[model samples]
Structures are given as structure tokens and as C-alpha cells.
Target: MATDALKNVRIRIERAAQKLGSKIVPDWMLEELVEPEERFSISINVKIPNPLNPLEKIPKKFKAVRVWHRKPDPADIWKGGLRYHPDVTLSDMEAHAIEMSFKSWIMQLPHGGAKGGIAINPYEWSKDTLEDVTLQFAKRAIKRGIMSPRIDVMAPDVGSTKIIMDWLRDYYIDYTGDNIIGDGVVTGKSVGKGGILGRESATGLGMHMALQTFCEAGEICLPKKKTAIVQGFGNVGSNFCKLAGEYNISVIGITDQFGGVYCPTGLDIDKLINFASANKYKTINGSEVISPTYMKASFDELIAAGADMFVPAAMEETITTSVAPKMNFKVVLEGANGPTLADADNILIQRGIQVIPDIYANSGGVTVSYFEWARNTRKFHTNPGILIPDNDETSVKTALQVMFKKNGNALIKVAKKYKIPYREAGYALAIERVAPDIKARNRMD
Candidate 1:
């Protein structure tokens, strides 16, 4: 099955290269692209002794897998996220790790790609139970020499949160006998736990920056009152909406897993944020903020509501071939990894809708993670009065602009030179950056 998946990915890469009218890919590049350096799977068993029934201890078993698509350089700077989902498998981890490799390369970060997650329904586990399981997993990973600040940095992903990251950090520190660099071993921690200031909203801000840069390069004028439809009001989606005002983009429609709300005149982002904050970030329901103007909508309805831009910040493969043709937005900026499947790329291209690839569009989180990791490695304690500058909103925004400008320009150059969709062009550019590194290290020879 893994071989078949790799073959399929290679076929897509070949097709994309052909469409670009570029030179044929070297055999070594194809080989490196289709294989990962390492894959590890571990089984974690956590015993939760029932207080009511002291005689019986329930043992929950979780299957976890981590994949390093490309090993870190000598300095050992590698990055990825850890998710807790019931359906996660080794194959999924390997594929996502490969995507992370491309994402990091596109951003020009000095890190390779790695990803791991456990097959457990986080919603079903008690907070204490979850922490125990996470600690157990961290212990096993550290014993295997795969979890550390310079080796493999873990962050939050779906079904995971900052609290879980804090637990991971604590467990790692315990195991390492209070290593000073332990805090850097896991990112996405709460501000009180050594996390960077602007790390939370980095991805959303990055998306906005990508949109603005893409528009300027295309000579497309954003509507004076620019409106957007965001699918998924999770961390990325909500933060995007929260910071939309910076770019003069108003979110007219937003959705969660349960349902959606739409207002033609634009819903109040602050009000929606307050409502979600008060209600566990669920759908906006029938609140007065959504009163007469806001109407409940479906996923399909919201996507086709004819907004100026559509941001799919939700799950992967959401924008499939069937849905791509019906999408009415002028532009589609992916805020989630692989939100649009491979086959859907041509369909959206035929409709003349530009897509900002996730590799470049949703890289804000990793960029900020890099910043946090850098802070951890710096010698801030050398002088008592010296303080490390905080990564505020303005600094994050500026850093993202620089990153977006460089990569966005590369996206355009590759797309125009190869005459392919932006997604394929991004893949080509990222591969160009990464493949050479592997060659330089003589790993692909």
C-alpha cells in the first residue's frame, strides 16, 4: 500500500513537471522524493485505575507513529507537529512529514520535516488521562533519542493543544534531568510556559500576507470592502478573522464543525470571537450578533456564497474535484495542508481561480516555531539586565511579510516560467531547494 502511494505521488510529480515544460527530473531526485529517511511506531499503554473500582485498572493502548522524511543536518534542527486522532496511521504520518519537508524548504527554514501522532480520540480522554498518555509517549520517544530541541521539535496539530505541548515539555524535562534547553523541545506552549508572543496567530497572519502579496503580484485589485468566507473557525481560521482588519479583509461567512453563519453585510468579527470564546468556539448559532442579517448555512452553501476570497482552513481533501468546479470565490488560499486534493488543482485552474499553496500560505506557524526555538537556544541568561526581544504582533507581521514576499515572488516566477498552477509551481520550487541539499550531503547519490 505504501509503495502504491509513493508511485501515485511520483506520477503526479511527473505530470506536474511535464506541464511545466521543464527539464526532466533527475532519477536521484525522484528517488529521494518518494522515500523517507526513518519511520518509527510505538505502542503506549496507560493504566487508569478507576477510583470507584479500585480492583480494576483500565488499560488504554494507543498506536503512535513518527516519520522523518528528511533527516536534520548536522545541527539537528527538525520540526513537526503531534496530533491525537483515532484514525491516524503510520502512512498518514509519513505523508504529512513529507509535506512538512516541502513546507520548510519553501520557507527557507534551516530545518527538515518530521511528524508524529497517536491514534487516540482526544475528546474521549479525560485531561489527566491525556496528560499521562502524552507523557508516556514522550518518555518512549526520548528514550529512542528522537525527541529533543535540536533533534525533533514537536508542536500542536489537530486534536492537540498548547496544554498538551506543555505536558510533553514537562515530561521531557523530567526524563532529561532538567535540561536547560528542554523548553525548546516542544513549541506551541502557552505564553506563561516560554512560548513566543505571536506564535498563536502566526499562521492566520501568514495567510493574510500571502493573499496580499499574491494580489499585488497579479495586479489584482482587492475590493475596497474586501469580504471573505472562512471555512473552519479553529485556531487558524479564528485568528485569520481576528487579524483580517489589518489587511482590510472582513470575514462575511464563517463555519465550525457543527454549522455555519453568514451575513451579507459582513459579520462582526469581534462579536463572533466573543461569542465563540464564551461558547467553546462552536458555531455562532442564533445569537443576536448574527440576528436578522446572519443566516445559518451549510458547508457547500458557504463555499459557494460568492465571497471575494475563500479560505479553507479546515481538513485535508475538503476541496475535491466535485467541489472545486462549484466554488465561486475569485481566489482560494489554503490555510490547511493539502485542503485541495491533487485532482482538484486542474479544475480550479480551469475556473481561473488562483490558489495560494499551503506550503507557502500556511507557514506562519512553523516560522514562529522557528523563532521560539531560536529564543530557546540563545544565551539570554548571560547578562541579568539583557532581555530577549519579544515577538509581538508587529514583529511577526514584518517577518511574515519578508517570508511571503520572497516565497510569493518565487511562486509567481515558477508558475509563469512553467505555465502550471501555483500549487505545482510551489512543489517544483520546494523540490528544487530541498533536492540540492540532499545532493550536497551526498544522501541522494
Candidate 2:
């Protein structure tokens, strides 16, 4: 039986389609819409001679072993995240790959998704050992014709960071002797190394954008000036809080794996960042710290913590049936992919809470990755990048204002005509241009 999570995803997609007035695409139509490139043929083969190898300590973390897969996806090229955590499994990666396809389609990016992860915790391995294991995995995957810059792009995920990415990049370069995006093989690279201008803050920026958009649309004035409760203080959650502060959004509660801390008078992001940086995964709560109340809080309790918006930036399946009933927020923005389960989505929607789907919400990272690739491919040229010049934004604003005046609410009319989510509308505009090229490649005419 399909797990409740998967079922929920399908149900939400259907509901979203209905909301947009899009026809429930029959399987045959879906097959036709699925270009040949849409199917991915992956050949994943890895051999671990020692089942008991201390390094091969992943089987116990997940249910079974000998992970491998081959899937048919559009774009012919596969790209996705690779995570290492105690609960990693092949099926987990498969699901992520499916989301990547949908996400790339949503973002209008010409790519597909596939993810891989080992269940062993990184904390258990020394830096050198981790490097060796990563390189070995890379070599094995590469030799088997599985991973490559052109064939499949890989990025850091849970329990993995830029350091591991750097090591993998160097090892690939040494083996291939060809420049693979010159430190662009992996996204999320440190700033000095061709990483984009705001890469680290991209996820948070997307979350803020979602929250801001929701507030504007719903006209929900926060009780006390855009206050929020963030469940995970990892990269996405912490940076989100920090950037939210820049927008004058107050962050009240934050939790890390260890525990959470709260303060009504917004926590100091700089101090928390500095403390976490120094303490190596430890969370701080101002000068006066106490153990977190979040660890024991039900998922509903966590979201219903009297905040304007709740961000589940942590793990998947955290917001399931049992927890969705308790959420009291006006908006639930998912900073992490698939953070909310399918069943929970219906409940939240029925409650009239605007739940920002992951496809659009977390796309900033991939969008920036596309930027980094473009930069490297162009040899890091002096030309302007994705950053919209002030003049351009002003020009666009002026153009829209002029159009609105001439055709009074023309934008709204167009929006209603399309009957699409604003995010999907943005994507449709972009994909209309890219889809032609994708089609042209297979044209016999």
C-alpha cells in the first residue's frame, strides 16, 4: 500500500489542478504530455564487498539494503539532492526524484530529479573518513555512468555540506580532466568559490517571499508585526528568520535537533548564528537559555504557537494527519520539499490556511544553481547576472502601472482567465519559451 504521505501528495496535486480549473489529465494525455525526455533511464550499480564494513553502516538505519534504481524521466538529464541521514533509503531518493521532475517543470528548468543518500550519520565519521567515502562513492557512481555534470547534477542535502561537495568536485575533476562547471558541479558552494551572490540566503528569501505574498493576499495583519515560529533552525529555518528580520518580521521561536528556544522579543539572529557556529550544532536562546519545549510539543502545538505564520522547514512527514488538525496559522509556508503530507493538505486548505507548495517555494536554490551554471559556462563573464537592475524593476513597475491604467485591472483579468496560481502563472510564462526548444529537438518536421 502506498504510504499516507504519497497518497497525500497525489491528492493535493489533484486538488490543486481542480482549483486551477485544469482538466484532470487522463493517464493517456499525461503520457502524451510526457515527452520522451521526460522519462529517465538511470543505471545505478554499486557494490559493497563488505556488508559489515563499518562504512557500509546504512542497512541498519533503513529497512533493506542494496539500493539501486532506473527510472524514465523527461529531459534525459537527472538532477537531485543526495542526503546522508539515519533514515535514508532508496525509496526516499526515488520520491525526491519525482518531486524534482515536478519542481523543474514548475520552475521551467530543463532538468529532472534523482536523489541518493546513505543512512549513516555524518557525526559518526571523521572529516577524512567522510571525504574518502564520498570520493569512493563518486568514483563508483561515475565509473558506472551514473553521475556527471551533463548527465546528472548532484547537490548537498541532509548531513552533507559544501565541504563534502568540494571534495567530490575535486575528485571528479581529477578523474575527468574536463571542467565540469568549475566548482559548479555542486550548488550551495561557499561564496568565494563561484557561488551565487545570495545562495546561502536563497531558501529563506523564498520563504519570506511566500509569507509576504500570503499576507498581502489575505490582508492578515499579524497581531504583532509579522511574527513567526520556525520549527527547524538549520540552514533554511535560521536564514529565513534572519532575513525575515531584515523585512521587519519578528521571529519568536526556533528549534534545532537538540532543542528549541523562544522569546517574545525577537531572538538575536547574529548571536544565535555565532553561538551555533561556535558550538557545533548547539542552539542558543539569548543570554538566558533553557531546554526546548518543542521536543515534546505535538506537531499541532508547534504550529499553533500563536504565530502569524508557521514554517515547517525541518523534515518530511512532520505535518501528517495527527498534526494538521492543530495548526492555527493563517499561512503555512513549506521551506522544505514535501514537508507536509497529502492528507494534512486537505485539512489545512479546508481550514482556509494558505499552504505554499514546495515546488514553487523552495525553487530559489535551483534557480540560483541555474545562475551559477550559466556564469561558469560563460566563463564567469562581466555581463549582468540574474539580479534585476533597479532600473528594470522600476521599468517593469511603470509598464505595469501604465497597462493597468489603460486596461483597468487587466492583470487581474489575465490572472482570472488563466485560472492558475500566481506561481504557476510565473512558470507558464517562462516554460512557454523553453518548451518550444524542448519540442524542437525531437521534431521530424
Candidate 3:
């Protein structure tokens, strides 16, 4: 499975480079483009009381990993998220890390790519136990040089949150005794704890902006019709669904990891958001209620729902070879990283279904995260404890310009220049930005 992830990224990188050829992108850089610079993983055992046998203790091992696809120069920092999910692995981290590099490069952030996450189900563990294990991960991570403000900046992802990030930040401050830059060690902290405003809805908002821009430019007319299916109701998916109606972009069907509600006509995004938020059965899946306007959806029904656009905000490898051919959408906006498999990508390309790639489409989270980092680091020499105000509307708009308008225009330019699709143009543009060799080659020409 891990190999598949890397292969998928390799396929993307090679294809992107193919458009430019060896003259502009040298052959030697392909190895670096396809492989990570370094990989580190740590696994430690923690004991929990056996559920049936309360007196007995059970030992469980948890793994946390970081992969650096593009190691930064001496003065730069490596940025990524620390996800807490059961399915996380080293290779998955590597693939996501490479995507981070691409995302940052295209966004022109002064940072390189890295990703790390610990494998654990936060729902199953008690808060006390979760905090203990998290602090343990933090102490060891800092000691081993796996995490630092400049070395590797952490953010929340998947099963992570602001509270968990706060715990990690405190531990780093204790370890380094540097009260100044400690908060900068991690973004996504609560605004009172040095987090930036608008971090939560950044990714979804960014996707919404990009999609709207495409519609407004007469690139796609789906927004006028509002026919779309949103997969995954987490931060990215839910926020996206909530904001789509602002542009009259209607979502006909939506699903989570377990199930969701589907309506042939547009479903009410606000009502769904409220229900999902109040749902106690976990955010992704809950018991469903049927109505004349909407019906409880099974996973199959949601995927089978036809629409002009598909927003996959759930997980990686969602659109497999079989799933790809069955897709009913004309455009796939990747809200989740690596949502489409390599073969699925080819199928989509062959079918003329354009993909708004994840590296560019869903970059709103990191884009706002960069805002948090810059804000936190700016106060490093001053009183670090002073909480910044949560005035993020302006910041969110700035992110829209950087991600949707600027990067979106750049992708169009590259696609036209190379006669390639947006996905290939995205990767090629990232490669062109990160590799100075292109400029050197162009000069020699």
C-alpha cells in the first residue's frame, strides 16, 4: 500500500516532468523528485488497563513518523502535519511529504516539505492517556531532532486538533526552555495560544474560491447549476459544503467515511452541518433519518450519485481503477490529498474529466498555517505569550488570492504552454519553481 502511494506520486512527478523534457528539467533531478531525502519513524509502547480484566495491563505500541521529501536549506524550515490516525505509516508520510513540497513550491512558501503522524485512535483513548502518550511522543521527538521550529514545524491533520497541538507546544517549550520561539514550533494552536485566525476553514474556503473562480471565468458552468457531490464531511468537506451555496454552488449529494445524506435535488448544507456537528456517533458516520426531500445514504449511493463535479475530501486512494471508470462527474476537485490513484488518474484523463489536483486545490490549510507561523515567529523576540487577535477575514482573502487567483492563473499558463492538463501543469509548475536548474538551462539556451 505504501509502495502504491510512492508509485502514484512518482507517476505524477515523471508525467509532470515529461511535459518540459530533459532540456528544461534535467534528467538527474528526477531521482530527487521521485524520492524523499530522509525518513524517520518512532514506535513506543504504552500500557492501558485491560477492559475486561481491569487489574491487568495491556501493552500497545504507537508509531509516529516524519518524512522529508525536500530538506530545506540551512535557514529554512520543513513544514508538515502530525496526523493521529490508525492507518498512518512511514510510506504514507513520505507520499504526503512530497505533496507538501509540491504545495509549498507552487504557493511559493519559503519552506520545504515534510509530514509526520502518530498512529492512534484518539476516540478510543481517555484524555489523560492521550495526553501522556502525546507528551511522550513530544519528548522523544524533540530529543531525536525530529521536531523543531526550524527543522520541522507541525500542524494538525486528520484525527488531530488544536488541543493536541497545544500539548505538543508546551512540551517543546519545556524541552528547549526557549519561551520565545516555542509557540512557533507548531501552528493550529488555539488563537489564544498563538494560533492564527481562520485556520479551521482555510482549506475548504480555498477550494471554494478556486472552484468559484473556475465557474466565474466560464471555465465550467456547474456552479450555476449547483450539481456536485461532496465526499467527507470533516473540516475540508463540511466547510466546503457550507460555503458552496454562497456562490449558488449546490451540492446534490454528500457522504462521510461511514455514510451521509443524499438528495437528488440540492441538500440543505446548513442543516447537514448542524446535524453532523451535533452528532455523537462520530463526525463521519451516524444513524440516518429519512425524509421526502433527502434520504439516508449508503456509501454506494453517494458515490453513484451523478453530478458535474466531485469534491473528495475524505481520504487517500479513494478513486481506484474501478471507482474511476464509475465516476459520474466531469471535474474532480481533490480536497483530500492523494484522493485519486495513479491508474484512476489516467482513467480520468482519458475520459476528459479534469482534476483540480490536491497539491494546489486543497492548500488552504497550509496557506493559513503559514500565516500562523509567520505571526508566531514575528513575536519571538517580544512577549510570546501575548495572544494575537482572531481577525482572519482579511487573511482568508489573502490566501484566496495566493492560492486560487495567483496559483490558478499560473497553472492555466503552464497548461497552455505545455498543452497539458491541470494536474500535470500543477506538478510541472511546482518542479519548475523548486528547481533552479530550469532557470540555468533556460539561460544557457
Candidate 4:
């Protein structure tokens, strides 16, 4: 399956190149094109070796590429996220890297994606221990020439947070003798560390917008009989729930690492947020009409909870062949990249589920990260003061407003421009723009 995804990605790139009448892109360029595949493969292989282990087994030694330097050349910065999961792999990072590159192109970002992660249970690690691990990872990545603030950049991803990002970035800074010039090497930093506002909610906001776009296109009035089930309630899931409520969509079910929650009537997001906030990290499902029911269950149960939309914000491979056939939803908005495996995707597509591919569906976080990268580069070069202090949020907000402001016009425009799915339109627009840039660079050389 991993090999197949990589092959498909390669075919896509080659087809894209052919359309431009260029020789096939170089292998190195191909790497950038399908970086996420490499990362996903490595992650899945390492975390889940066999069927017996399932989700319980953990890898003994998690491999990672890290680096450390006192000073570096100017063209080595890269950035992306680091995941902590039993199933993390280099292929997973590779897949994300490719998207980061395309996403950067879509937004006209100067940087590209470079993801990293460890195959371990983040839940088992303490803060101090995690910091130590981060520093070690940073040193290793730096030594391998796989990381730099100069060319490749990094941010937080699954099982990682602002604290981890701060620790990793600080390690880089300290190793470089406080190279103030390259602080932007690591993004998703704390606010004081130059991180942008709305970082936490950026992905969720984008998912909501994508859903809104999807809804407006079909003329489906939301929250009318609409109910949603979010598989993961961390930053992405919770934020998505909040935004969905704002749009008047009823999030009837939500789950976390602990358990699942459900209600017949709409669940009050504010109440759920407050309850989950205090109860460690458990699921909250209770209401006057539906009564409270919480228990330890598989993530698949959430999908079958009978909602209009099922959002797999949890992790990759959550919805598989066994699960997709049972899901009863109109649309599946992939909040997490690669959430639905290829086999499941085929099943869901045949089952009439509108599967929003991750490449376009989950691009919001990276889109904003691109904004941060743009701001950082401008500040770094002091290049005509091109840094955007407030434009990232404003621009995306405006674009979304345009997308949803008038449902009728937006629907007609989207339908007429592309008779395909909304997800395809979003990705096609991004890919079309990026392909030209790649071609222009080749021509210049």
C-alpha cells in the first residue's frame, strides 16, 4: 500500500511534468514531490510491525535524523512538523514534505516542508524528558543536514506542541551560538518566540472553511439536520468543533485518546470544552434528553455514530477497509492527512461518500505556517519590509468570506469553474500554481 501511494504520487508528478512539456523532473525533485509518502511509510512500518501488536506494541528504538551546528550556510533552512506516534515513518514525513512544498507554492512561500518525528508514545514522556529528546533529535537532524533554519523549517504536529517546538528551536539556537538570524528555522514557536496568532486553531479553521465551501456548493443548509462526529479532540478536533458550532452545525459526537461521546440533540460545545478541560483527557457525552454514556471504545465507533459528516482528526489509517463499509455519513472531511488509507478511500468513494483528500482538505495549518515562513524570511533578510504581521489571517479570512459570503454565487462559480469535487478544485488551483513555479525555476537554470 505504501509503495502504491508513492507510485501514484510519482505518476502524478510525471503526468504534471508532461503537461508542461518538460523532461521528467529529477529524482531529488521527485523526493520533494512525494516527501510525505516517505515519511508515512517509515512511521507506519516502525509503529505497527504486525497485526498481533495492533496499537499496543511500541518500537524499542525509534530512528530519527537530527543535526547540530554552531554556524551554517544560508541555504539550508527547512520547516515542517514532527509527529510522535507508534506508526510514524520517514515516508510519512516525505508525504508531508511534498505537501509543504506545494502548499508553500500555493501561498507563494519562500520555504518548503521538512517533517520529522519519533515512533514513541508521547503520553509516556514527561515534559523534561520530552525536552531532552527534542534537543537530541535536533542535534541528530542538524548533523545529518536534514534540518536547518536556513533552508528547511519545522513546526509541531501530532503528539507535539508549542512547548516541544520551543525546546527544539531553542536547542538549534543554542547550538548555533544564538544565531538570531535563523530563529525562524523552527516555526509554531510561542507567541513571544515570534509565532503567529491563531496557530492552534488554524487547521481547524481551514477545515471548517472547507466544510463551509462544500456545504455552500451543494446548497446544504447546515445544522438543519446536520450532525458531526469528530474522532480526535485535541487541537484540531476541538477547534473544528468550535468552528462548526459557530456555523451552527451540531457536533453530536466527539472522542479523544480516552473514549467517545454522543448525544441525540446537539451537544453544547462550550460545555463539552469546559468539561473536557478539567477531566484530564477523557470523552464527554452527556445531555438531558440523550443521557450520559461514556466508555472505552475503538475510534471506528465514532464514524458509525450516524452523523452527516465524520471528521477523522485523530490520526492516519483510522478509517480502514473494515471501518469504511460501516460508516454512515454523507461526507468525510479528512482533518488529518492520510487518515483514510487507499483501500478505504476506494470503498468510501464507491459507497457514495464524498472523500475530501488530505492534500487540500488539511492544508489550512500549513497555509498559515507558510505565512509565518514568509514573515520570518522577510524579517531575516530585512528585504523591503515584506513581512506580514497581520495579513495571513486576514487574507485567508477574506478568501473564505468570499467563498461563503453568497452561497448561490459561490456555488455557481465553483461548479462552473470545475465540475469536479470541491477538494479537487482546491488542490488543482494549488498544484497549477506550483507547477509553473517549478517550471520557471528550471527555465531560469
Candidate 5:
């Protein structure tokens, strides 16, 4: 259940804040931030094409979104994604939305955190079925006033993609009769349809940048000798693998939901990336490229195979207590949210393994989403009251890389001074950024 996961997330936040003493921090933030300000349970009673029978349609029942923190959304503030996974639930959305709040706050995006998902496995449906259901959801969302450019913005998540977002943006534009200019309503669209240049691989790029910052701060050199293992070759993991090789970091192992492979001499990420794209972004086989001896059928074998870095980019709580102790990595670059639970994280820290937290590490996706939002909303002459500057991939990367290095140094300094783990230091840093906003809005000062 998401309850255990939610508790694990909150406990870490509380632990970090308490070390700072709660006095300077606004009381309302601790009490209020834990609970979402808005909860949306959209009932999608629609008939979608069934793969088994074209004459009949299947019914989809539910969709959920949680707005953790934002001003009135018409201020065009909240930003997040809609995931389509069989395991998606309201509780999980709530947790992800809260994480978005932390991510946006730390990245200083012009957004608060919001997220929702339709609990369906997209793999079971045909392309037509997927598009029909996505459009239905988009129409329902528009009719209910759940989404708009001047309100909440949606992006891609697990089981979601750029084409899906393009559909939402297209529908919104058509539905509004071109009155609202719907491109800004959802991000991560095809670049031809208002998507930003870096949006495709922003999360992975952001993590890579953060990794470089942390490595520089720690005086670690990235060479071909530095091997890395990445779990999940989906968008985030695959993009990261492509870029990590640029720094001469050899990715020795890679795993998708179907299977994984390991090669101490480093696998060809380009080959695996192409294979996964053809296989729905899930890497199943690589024997044609990698030596047959390096194939790992499960994540355990890859963990057992060993590397200097391990990225649990697939799912939450993948690095549990048992997995934590078995990990051979010197550092963990969180490519997925909440991949390491509290207990497992403490285990890694105790073993002197550095953890680059997800909120900071995987923030590239939302950061670029911000750029897309700025670009899409640029046509609007209306005053929602904040001035967001123009953005492209290059300027965004330069500005954010500098911010990341500065923040990384600050977090390390605080971690050293407080004698706390890097994760805790990150939470403290995020809290410090968020507190002033919370205080000003509430007149807490």
C-alpha cells in the first residue's frame, strides 16, 4: 500500500527539519505541507476500444490527481505529470505530488507540485485504444475545468510519453475553439507542437548535471574506469545512459522491466537504447551486442555483478534493506523518486556511500517543463502576475548547472557541519527554500 511509502517519505522530511530546530521554520508548513491542498478523483466512465473485440469496448473507471501545494492554480503555477501504470493509486499520486512540491521548490520553478494518474497498463491496449482513452480523459478533464494553460499543467510520467502529451495539447486547443491556445495546458509534447527542445531527456540530463556537481565537490574523476549500473532503460534511465558515456563513465550494466545485462568492459548504451526504443522503451535482450556471458536475467544478478555507481531508476523502494547491503556502488544517483526507503538509505549512508537525492537529481524533467510552459504561455497577454523569461535548452542548462553546483556545495557544507547524511542535508536545503514562500503567503512573519 502507498501508506507505508508515504510514511517513509514524510519521516525523512521531519528528520531533516527537526535537526534545524522548528522555530524558524513556519509551523504551518510542517503541518500543512504533508497533506495535499486539493484532491481530484476524476471518474472516467468511458468505453475504449478493446483489443480482443473491435465490436466491443472496455470501461475505464478512475483517475486521480493530488495538488500538494500551489496558489490558486489559475495563476498557472502547479505542474506535474499523469502516469499510466496498473499500480497507480490516489495514495501514490499524493506522494508523488508532494515530492513535486519539493522538486519545484528546490529547482525554483514557477510551479508548485501536482500529479495524477489513470491506473491502467498501457501495454495491454493497442495504439488506437490508448489514443481513444487518452483523448476521453483529456475531454473529461477540460469539461470539468480540471486543466488549462492558466491553471494546472500536465506532463509525461511512467507509461506516458511525448505523443500522449501532444494529444492532450491538441484536444485542448480544439476544445477551446482556439480561444485558450491550449499548448501550455500540458507539457512534454512533440517539439513541433509546443514541446521544448530539452523536454525529452531533461530528467536524465538534470541527474547527470547533478552527478557532475556532486563528483566535482567530492573530487572524484569520471573516467572510463568508473563503471555504472542503471536499472530501468525507460526514458529517464536510457537518456542518462546516453549522456553518462560522454563523461567517460562506462555503464557496465542496464536493466529494464523485462531483463538486464552486465559487462565489466561496459555495454554499448547506443545499441541498448535503440533496442529498448523498438521494444517500447524496455530493454529485453542485448546478446546480439553484448557478450552472452554478461546477460543478467534479474536485477539481483546485476547488483551482484558490481559497479562504481548504481541507479535504481525503475521504481520506488527498489533498494530495500536487503538490496542496500548487497549494492556494490560507491554512489547512488536517484533516477527514480523514492527508490531507496529510509532504512535502506541509512544503511547506504552508514556504509559511506553517497546518495544524490531524487528531488534534486531527477529535477531536469520538470525544469524543462517549466521552459515549455514559459514558451507555450508566451502568447498570452493576460496578466497572471509573474514574469517568466524566455527559455531554450542551452540557456536553461547553463543556468541550472551553475545553480546545481552552488546548491551541491551548500548541501555538502551543511551535511559536513551537521554531521548528517546528504539526503537529510538536501531536505533541509529544500525546506529552507520553501519556508519563506510558505511564511509570506500565510503572513507567518
Candidate 6:
């Protein structure tokens, strides 16, 4: 008997297909999409031992879960993010890993999908204690042979940062005595520490590219001053707004966890960014700030604000069925994973609101992570004296633009040929790419 959660996932999948006016996808594909090849639960003690109580050697234990969606290929490469959220669960990890696999396939990366994360709010831990927790987790994973440069590479995700990624890499290097391939073991590090340039802005850049491609394909001429409303103000949202400004897309309304700011004329993204930077990147209160033109608004008000584009960059399932009908944007660009629920997708399609699916829109991070991994691996294999050209912001940006255009064009082509929604078209294309490998490995029924 399927659990209620499993049943809900299946219903969502079926609803997605129905929205596209297509039958449910293959059973094998559906099975592989939800099941993990391997799962791991790790428990580590974060507290120090007390000499007074010798019997209490083990302190408070922090739990974590890791999942690999499929066995690594011949090169033994698997890639994913290491999130650190209080609500991290085994089921969530599995679902996220599966989506990573789809994302990798859509981007045509050779690596399989994997995810690992500790279930703790990093804000509660001191810097030193957080480092210790990260080190213990890495040690356990490395001991199990599930984490390495050529095996499983990890990047930052929700509640994780470049600082934490640097810690993971440094700890691994210290453990392995400065191994040659150490840098490739983790990505999203500071550029000075062997991280690639433009990695920080990759996801947002990808979102910009996705929206551009979507507009061009639909023959919808964007306004002279493109307008947008963003639902999240975190790294992804802020960076996305930055890129949008560069592309002439003025963000008129923006929201965070607390509240939002809206302006008909448009908010100065750079000034807003500076203000948020000074205030710990919290919610932007227009009234409290120097800008009287900006008014405080609710998240729903921001979403419903008329704009050229609607971007949900925060959490999943934010656009529910009821919320979908109220959205008044030319298109919805998914900057976060599963931002729109399947039921909402049907409503959006009926309303002629196109959605550039998360798998296609938010793939920039992983794509650039692949670039960093390749660069590191190349450097590791080459002679130290040989100077391999390092990738810069321009090169990374150009490569991402090319990829976004290519994939976006392919997705539009599929959608037209099959007469399906863009989301379904993306899934079909990704499944087509991954199905052959699964069949070759004799995983098909």
C-alpha cells in the first residue's frame, strides 16, 4: 500500500500530465523519478564532552539525510547540494534528489543526482560550532566513500552558504593531506579558494536567460522597460533582480518572509540591495526607509501585481490552485524548485499563463557547478606547471546564455510538436534523455 505522501506525489505527477493534455508518463520513468538508489541517515554529536561527566561523552546528536537518485556512471560522478534546514527529511531529500537528476538531464550533464543535508537551523549555531558540525558530517560521508571529488560533489543549497562550502572543502583537504583533487570535491567556494567566477550569480542569470527565451519564443515583445515582481529576496531573488535591472527589467514589487515593497514607477534595485545588505538582508520596509514612493504590500499583493513577469524564487508550492487564477503576469519563471503546484499548473494553463518550469529555469547553479568541477578535475589531471586558462565571469555567462537558449528553444519545439504545456514538454525531453541510460542499465521493466 502506498503511503499518503507517496499517493499525493503520484497524484501531482498525474495532474501535471493531465494539465498538458497528455497521458501519464511511463511507469518506469515515474518509479525512477521518486525512488532513490541509495539513502543514508547520519547522526553526529555537535556538543563538546565535559570532563566532569565522563559518562556523558556524547553530546547532543544532530541528524542528517543524504540520497542518491541513481548509481554513478563510469566516471563515478554524482552532484547535488547540501542544504541545512530544520525541516530536512528523508522524503524531502529523496524528492529533491530526483528533481536534481531531472535538472541534470535537462542540462545534459553527465553527473547523476544526489543530495545531503543536516537538519539544523544554522542561525542558532556559533561559527566555530557550525564548522565542527560540518567537519563531522564530512568525515562520516568521506569514510563511507559517498563523498569525494570524483564520486559525489556537493554545492550550497537552502540554509547553506559559500562559507560553509569552503569549510567542507578545507576539512576534506585536511583529512586527505591536501589531496590533488580536493578542490573539485566541493563547489560554490569563494573564487580565491578555487571557486569559479560568476557562480554566485549563476542561478539568477539562468532565470534571466529563461525569461528572455520564453518571451522570444512566444513572440511577445517585452516592454521598453520590462517590469517584474519577485516573491523572494534571498540570494536567488536579489541576484535575479540585479540581472533583471541589467537586462532592463525593472522590479516594481518585491517580497520576503515578512512583507514587501511595491512601487508603480519601479524600485532602484541597487539602492534596495544596499539597504538590505546593511540590514542583514531582511525584509525591505519602504515606509521605514528613505523612499516614500514605495509602499508596503503583502506577498499576495505583490504576486497579483501586473507585471511582464512573475518570479517565485523562495519556496515550493507557493502558487496554489487558488493563487494561480489571481496571477496577472505574462509568464511565471520558476527560480525555486516546484514553486507552482500541479493543480495550479492546470489553472495557469487554462488562463494562458506560460510557466518556464523549474527544471529548465533554475538550472544555472548546477550547470556552473559542473563548470567548476570540470575545471578542478582538469587542473588535477594536468601537470602543475601547465597553465590551464581559468574560467571568468564573461566565459561563464556566455556559456550559460548559450545553454539557456538551446534548451529553451528545444523545449518550445517539443511543446509545439506535442501540443503540450511547457512544463510537460520539459519533462518529456528530460525523460527521453535519461530513459536510454536507464534501459541500457537494465532498469526498465
Residue 198 shift from truth in candidate 4, angstroms: 0.8
Residue 403 CA displacement from its true place in model 6, Å: 1.0
Candidate 3 segments exceeding 4 Å error:
55-58, 279-281, 284-287, 379-391, 437-445
Q: After superposition, how far is residue 102 of candidate 3 from its true place, in Å?
A: 0.3
TM-score of each: 0.90, 0.74, 0.91, 0.75, 0.91, 0.89
Order of quality (TM-score): 3, 5, 1, 6, 4, 2
Counted clashes in each candidate structure: 0, 11, 1, 49, 1, 0
Candidate 4 lDDT score at position 416: 47
Please write out the lDDT profile of model 3 over residues 1-445, one tens digit for every residue: 5568778988989999888888656777777788888988878677888999978989878988888887434456899888888898998899999999889877767677888888888878888778877898888888888677767898989888899999998889888997777788998898888787788888898887777656666655563556788888877888888888776678888887667777787877776777776855355354245347777776567767768889999889888998888788889999999998888878888988888889888988887787688777773223232223335777456645545777778877898899888888889998887677434433433
Report the Cα RMSD per candidate.
4.0, 6.8, 4.0, 7.2, 3.1, 4.5
Q: Residues 140-191, candidate 5: write the lDDT tens digits.
A: 7788787888778899999999989988888888888754456788999998
State model 1's lDDT: 0.78
Residues 125-198, model 2: lDDT tens digits:
56755665677677776786666666666776767776777776777778878664646566666656555566
lDDT pick, better of 5 and 6: 6
lDDT of 6 at 119: 90
Candidate 6 per-residue lDDT, tens place, 39-97, comes to 89979887755569855644777898898886424554888999888877777777677
Residue-by-residue lDDT tens digits, candidate 4, 1-445: 4444344344444444433334434444444454342222221222223347654744434555321111111243455677776666555555556555544443334444556677766776556456655676777667655656565577888888888878877777787775654557677778777677777788888777766765766634445556888888777888888888676678877776666666657667777777767654334533222345433334566666678888888776677789889998888888886676555656876888876556555666775665565565565344231234464556646543442333323333443465644333433444444554554555532
List per-prediction Cα lDDT, in the order shown: 0.78, 0.56, 0.79, 0.60, 0.76, 0.78
What range of 10 consecutive residues in model 1 has the weakest lDDT sum? 379-388
- Which is superior by TM-score, 2 or 3? 3
Residue 120 error for model 4, in Å? 2.3
The stretch of ten residues in a row with the least summed lDDT in candidate 6 is 380-389
Misplaced by over 4 Å in model 2 are: 14-26, 29-76, 180-182, 214-224, 280-301, 379-445
